[model samples]
Target: MSNVELTNMCMIYDRTNNRVLVQERVKSWKGIAFPGGHVEDGESIVESTIREIKEETGLTISELEPCGIIYRFNDQTGDKYFVFNYRTETFSGELLEETDEGRVFWINREELLELKLSDGFKERLPMFFDRKFSEGFGTWNEHNISELKFR
Candidate 1:
């Protein structure tokens, strides 16, 4: 069996405001991105997503719509990483201003592309908004350069 690491990310949308929740991460892999984190052992992917969002953004989210997935394989390490992507417009609770992960805020959908996004995050946008594509596959070389393609 191949070694794999599972993680998740969620795009919390506000339909009424035409915006989505974003995190400007202060930790590793910092930059503009969605709120999410690793799935703990024995936790379902969906459960982990809910927990991560709550911890990072202080919101209780539900009715998740599974949008797509992004997977990457590292040639040197022989490990594969998978990020199950989801989007939901249904959420409740007080929003957090900041967390150990980063600062959380809502931004207009159109303005998202204008900001400096985290590495590989720009390519993942289509999977969230474009129904035509449902997957992102990335291959990482020994040099750590990645080539990503969507389908």
Candidate 2:
């Protein structure tokens, strides 16, 4: 029998540059990742993503578009995460490091491919660029992430 874990976050794309926002953790892993985090109690995925964006980027996600949902399963351990990915079309405020997660940077679509990131995100982000905004929870079960695939 297999089970799953869940995490919440937002995927903010820079409208002006066609780049995406990410932060590089300063600690051990020293990797880059998006600016959102786990969903807090009593908060919806939308709420968590907005709050995380503000905290990590020092900006407000004013107009968020529901991009889609994803589920990522680890091939090694057979573990998984329920991911809620969103598109922030409109926003305000300057981005700054507001947490221990790391310093932030805006990376181009091609550059995103090279950065050392949470493997899950790197594998799943392509769908966002393709506009596969499906409605439903994503099910990641084996290092296999399907755009409109849900479980």
Quantify all predictions' global Cα lDDT against the true fold: 0.91, 0.68
RMSD, candidate 2, Å: 4.7
Q: List the residue pairs that clash in candidate 1.
A: none
* Model 1 TM-score relative to the real fold: 0.95
Please report how far candidate 2 places residue 65 from its true position, in Å.
1.8
Kindly provide the TM-score of model 2 when superposed on the true structure, using C-alpha atoms.
0.71
Task: Report the Cα lDDT for candidate 1.
Answer: 0.91
Name the best candidate (by TM-score).
Answer: 1
Candidate 2 Cα errors over 4 Å, as ranges? 1-6, 26-30, 72-80, 133-151
> On residues 4-72, what C-alpha lDDT tens digit does candidate 2 reach at each position?
555556668776888888788665335777666777777877888888788878889966776666665
Model 1 agreement with the true structure over 1-151: per-residue lDDT tens digits = 5588899999999989899999998896789999999999999999999999999999999999999888899877788999999999899999999998989999999999998899878888888887657888887856776767888
* Candidate closest to the true structure, highest lDDT: 1
RMSD (Å) of each candidate, 1 decimal: 1.4, 4.7
Task: Candidate 1: list runs displaced more than 4 Å.
Answer: none
